[model samples]
Target: MMNINEHLLRTFEARPGEFLSGEELSATLQVSRTAIWKHIERLRQEGYEFEAVSRKGYRLVAKPDKLDVEAVLGRLHTRVLGRSIHYMNEVDSTNNVARELVQQGAQEGTLVVAEQQLAGRGRLGRKWHSPKGKGLWMTLILKPRIPLHFTPQLTLLVAVALCRSLRQITSLPIGIKWPNDLLIDGKKISGILLESSAEEENLNYVVAGVGIGVNLLPDDYPDDELRAKATSLAIEAGHTMDRSEILVAFLQELESLYDIYHEQGFGPIKLLWEALSVSLNRPVTCQTPKGLAEGTSLGIDESGALIVKLQDGTVTKWYSGDIQFSS
Candidate 1:
């Protein structure tokens, strides 16, 4: 059964630029006129603009610039991704919360989201700036029945889904760096961090932490260093976008691609990812835990490791590293 708010939204969407009278809504929703009025008032408080006349009732003129569980679910059309949501006004990290929930037997497609992350972190323990309600700071808990080694491919899968989703919203040239850093105009715009646990050969759960800078401006950065390296969707598009719509599109694309990954394999996803890659066939160096290796990137192998052909006619695969490009 649909909720009253969702019903109201559908009614407004079904008949755009047309007034819905109180008697009509009351009869259609099987509720009192007072109930309809209350729901409309709540939507208005959430930044919905309504044109209310004496007897002409309400008409939706605008929507909120926010992304919450309700907003995402309102527009979501997916099978697995984003089926369950844990929304927070503020939290330390969505990934931490997602891991905790998965340990408690949370189902796949469970999403942990926050308006602000006090302890948000990217790969290599780098701090990720998550201001209040300025970006999509969320983590998805997935339980793919694959080996621990194959789990790295999910990061690449997420990069492809993210790139496709962002392309749907803006005309910016979005590309992926090795391992899954989303870049636009050669500047970082998003990052994906995957954490997982396994017992022997059996696989456990994987928490995918995703952070996308949406509505932030260059001045929002704390210092010039970050401003020079980071850019947001709003900064590139010259307008603020609806985070809810973007999240819904991302979930839909992710679900479709994830199903394809399970049925067919990683070949298709790898092709798509490589097509959007920026580091492939480029001169780069990986700073690993042992040391640094400089070579020309040969894209990725089957297991999603960074493949680099060194100058001395040797090839190496880097599982985890800080990649630096030396054009």
Candidate 2:
């Protein structure tokens, strides 16, 4: 299993240029020859390039193109957020993997990151575009002691943190679009999806999944219509971006803001979120299950609900709705 992979990885790192014979590896690892062979096969399947000669044995050649974990860990300044990272080159979804870890007793601040997602998703079951080596797809597991009703505030807090991080790293003007979308030049660049599990009166765990379209080229977008509505950091900056640096910066920002929210309350974070919010004080139309409500955006409530002030001067609080700007 993973133990064997770790052992092989350590051995390969220690003596990369030298070849270790099958018998020598079996004896050193204290495993059967069949086991060592199987582990090597698995490593090959996992994208670790290896050269095997008949009598000379196996030699590690190259590593898979992936996110630089060392670079990310080196720049990471938080005590949490990425203390323990589960990195994958490819996965179904980081959120799904993080949820599975939470069910198996993963600690708070545990992060699951993937370079590519085969089945990534956004809110309301919408498909999220995730091209390999082009974006950041990560999920963080959190176990807060707060009430279940207060969980939604974390979504807004993350939005503010992402906005700050993006500002620090790039010159692009990034803005928060309502609940959890991040926009650059009035086009979508990133989104956040928050899923939670709760007990009767307490919160069990929450998984906050963040997807940033970082290094995607303009031509990589699937459709022309969608391309007009979507954008990436590379497109806006006119250059390729370092995913490791951005990911580390984002984790640090999230950890700092999360500490503030846990110690004080959502009041302070809400103020920051509102300041970066682009939808407030603008004419907007919200699509609700009931019907469409057209009004000017007021602000978010104490519980993070979107507040809309209708033309009739009646203010309504919306818990879940699709928001659109009105010209």
Regions more than 4 Å wrong, model 2: 1-65
lDDT of 1 by residue, 181-200 (tens): 99997899999999989998
Q: Estimate each model's TM-score.
A: 0.80, 0.82
Clashes of 2: 0
What is candidate 1's TM-score against the reference? Answer: 0.80
Residue 321 Cα positional deviation in candidate 1, in Å, after optimal superposition = 0.9
Residue 237 error, candidate 1, Å: 0.8
Score candidate 2 by lDDT: 0.89
- Per-residue lDDT tens digits for candidate 2, residues 1-327, read 559888987888899699988999999889998999999989888678889999999999987547898888877888878988999888898999999998888999999999889999998889888887789999999887789999889889989999999989997899998898999878999999999988887999999999999988877888998799999999999998888999988999998999999899998999998999998999999888778889998899978889999878899988876799998
Sliding window of 10 residues with minimal summed lDDT for model 2: 62-71
Query: How does model 2 score by TM-score?
Result: 0.82
